[model samples]
Target chain A: MIKIDQLSKVFQTSNQSIQAVDHIDLQINKGEIFGMIGYSGAGKSTFIRLINRLEEPSAGSVLIDDQDITKLSKRDLRISRQEIGMIFQHFNLLWSRTVRENIAFPLEIAGLSKTERSERVDQLIQLVGLTGREDAYPAQLSGGQKQRVGIARALANNPKVLLCDEATSALDPETTDSILSLLVDINEKLGLTIILITHEMHVIQKICHNVAVMEDGRIVEQGSVLDVFSHPKQPVTKKFVEQVMGKPDNEVADDIFIQQVNSGKVLKLQFIGESTNQAFISQVAKKYDVELNILQGNIKQTQAGAYGSLYIQVTGTDEVVSQAIAYMDSTSIEVEVVAND
Target chain B: MTDLFPNVDWPDLMIATGETFYMTIVALIGALILGLLLGLLLYLTSPGGLWQNKYIHIITATFVNVFRAIPFAILIFLLFPVTIFLFGTFRGTTPAIPALIVGTAPFYGRLVEIALREIDKGVVEAAQAMGAKTSTIIFKVLLKESIPALVSGLTVTSIALVGYTAIAGMIGAGGLGDYAYFYGFTRRNFDIVFVCTVLIVIIVFIFQFIGDWMTKRLDKR
Candidate 1:
């Protein structure tokens, strides 16, 4: 486990000192996919960079597996740095070195022999699925392929922790999905604890088991991926969720429900885990003797369990409306009434 | 014109050609090593390279500019008493070599600094993130990565050295330029001048060719 405690970083420009990373306290568990989502200047990148001591923290401690890395000596720091592999936003591969040599760089620094470095490089090349491009330079590879090499190189030492600072932000969507999957594979196969930081919530929605939402150098909200996505608390967290699910137009949704259920009523329902099945929707409709209209419903299975939110318009007598509410209350689902248009 | 072109002294021509090669090679080795080290210090100590100490940067930069501002001809003539004191002889090829070293070191140092500064910061960051020590980042990263630019800088330095060697003829440095000035111009034999000029051209071409080959071979992108 990696524990980041009250870490802050201040960069001094010509005019004044600017705090890039505010006091942030976070814990990333072992073998977990953790995501830090924020805007460009929200300091997610700096937070990622701090873990590897690429940028030193101005105020707090970063304990990697209970050892405070901020106190390591220069020589010990180099050794500690090898344990925390980092993939960059621009895919900072050495242009002069071949893909194989680039991947073998850290191994060489670790004082591995030539034959051993080559063997490790070969294994990494195959792991990243770039078997034949070993002799090729970074310029010859596409954006996605270059990132794969970045991944292969970061994992050269089988690091216990991998810090990916906007690692997939430059790639296309299809490429992003594949790279995320490969990261998931690496996490599972090597048991490497991964911290993926990006502005895209879809990236978090896809792979992150736990997530922290950052804004203006501070983490405003953080929890399980499923909890945060399904029931986002903060405005920033909701905005991040909206980025993935599109803006849930409460006004438009109310208008559509009122137009459809003008004679009766409509209510928004949230179901998590066992209550998310079609049977629950049917059970309430059957008990109330009403026709159910699920205008918008989204379901996603997370590391925890299945979680989803649904918007429904039920048409029946007033007596049945209360019965439907009472029926939904029997299960672990939150039901709320939408106002008439 | 026929009388001026006669008595070309072929053996003297061979000896002068050998001397030119000796001076260029030796001076080039000394200047390149010193200049490269000085250039690296300039690069690292500048505003944002690795070490950004303004006081150190200003001091070294001022020192380089001071030596670099002096014209090679005047510099050779000016450093005469000191040169004679050190080497016990100011007129010979061995003593003239130090004059050339002093003349070209700072010139090439600035060139090397420019080449090193041109290296992309991304490449350096990549090496550092890979657990490379500072020494490794210098030798294995910056030097290896900046080879193409370094080669091009060296080409510029050697060509400039060729020009400086021509100026060295005034001090009787016994190179092709000296032969051209003494036997060709002073003795009024145009053939020696023409042959020496041709040989200098060929040498410049050789350096250019080698520089071009090195750039093409090392350029990764």
Candidate 2:
């Protein structure tokens, strides 16, 4: 487990001091994937660097597995760092070394024997799915392959905590998906605690179990992936949710409701978990004798469960539409009237 | 022209060539070791460097600049006393070495600094995150990544040294240049001057060829 208490970082310039990270507290459990989402310069990168002591905190303590790492000596910090692996956005690899040598570097620092280093490097190469490219240099590899080498190198010492600084932002969307799945695979196989910082909502939606949305050096909102996606509380979180949702709430043209319904209504229906799979729309229509038109629908599977949202227009007798709305309210699905005039 | 080239001193030419090789080799080894060390110091002491020290950076930079600003011909004259103190002579192949080194080391030091500075900052950060000690970062990351640049810098230094070595012959250092001055130009032996110029050019070309080949072989990027 990693515990960050009131962690803050300040950069002192010639003219003035800038607070890159304000007072923030966070707790990440072992074997869980946590993500921090923010725009550029939101200080998410600084927050993550503080965990490994890459950037010294201006205030507060970082306790990993009950040890306050902020107070460790320089020598002790080096040893502690071996347990915390980090990957970067641009894939900061040694351009001169081959992939195998790059992965073997940390092991060499640990003073492992030649045979042991080679054996461990071989294992990591296989683990990251770069078995045959061990002898190739980073320059020869594609962006995705370079990141795989970076992942392999970071995991060389079997670290417990993996920090990814926009790890997939450099790759294409298809490559991003492949890397995300690989991250999930490693998280499950090794039970490694992953803390990734990204600006992309799809990245958080794809693999993160929990997410903290940051704005201007502060976390605006944080919760489980499914909870946040289904019911975003803050405006910033809502904006991010809209990024993956593909359209804002106001963008739902009123014509769809006006033209399809005369003296009818438009309502948003939210489904989570097993509710998403059930034919609730047909059931509600048949039971209440209402004609339903789904204007837009989106369903996605999160780490916790399935979350789906649909915008619909219902046209029928007033009594039947009211009965259908009342029936939806009484069930597991959440329904809200968008425009009820 | 026929009268000027009545008899060429082949044996004397060979000895002068040998003496030139001797002086260049000795000076090059000394300059390489000292210059590389000074360059590394300059790099580490600069602002935001790994071991930044304002005083060290200012002092080293001033010293390198002051020495580098002096022309080689005048520098040889200026270091006459120091040369005699170190080697007990200031008028032979042995003494010319000190002059050559003094001229070449600081010039090459800047080259080394430039080569090291060109390395990506991200590469160093990655090494640090991996728990590499400072010494390890220098040896395994900085130096390793900049090998091609460093080798090319050495090539430039060596070619420059060839020119400086010729100039060292002014103070009775018996090399090809001295032979050209005393026997070729002063004695009006145009053939000797032509032959010495050809040899120097060939030597410079050899260094360049080897440097280019090694750089290409070492660079994986």
Name the lDDT value of residue A79 in candidate 2: 90
Candidate 2 local lDDT, A250-291, one digit each (tens): 565454654555557888877775336547888887798888
The interface root-mean-square deviation of each model, in the order shown, is: 1.2, 0.7
TM-score of each: 0.88, 0.92
Q: Give me the displacement of residue B71 in model 2, in angstroms.
A: 1.4
Candidate 2, what DockQ? 0.72
lDDT by residue for model 1 (B103-167), tens: 88888889888888777786687677777888899888888778888878887778778778878
Interface RMSD of 2: 0.7
lDDT of 2 by residue, B61-176 (tens): 88889989999999999999998899888878998998899898998889999999999988888888888899999999988999999899988988888888888886788788
Model 1, which residues run further than 4 Å from truth? A255-341, B1-7, B48-55, B85-87
For residues A119-188, write the lDDT of model 1, one tens digit per residue.
Answer: 9999999998998998999999999899999999899988889989899999999999899989989888
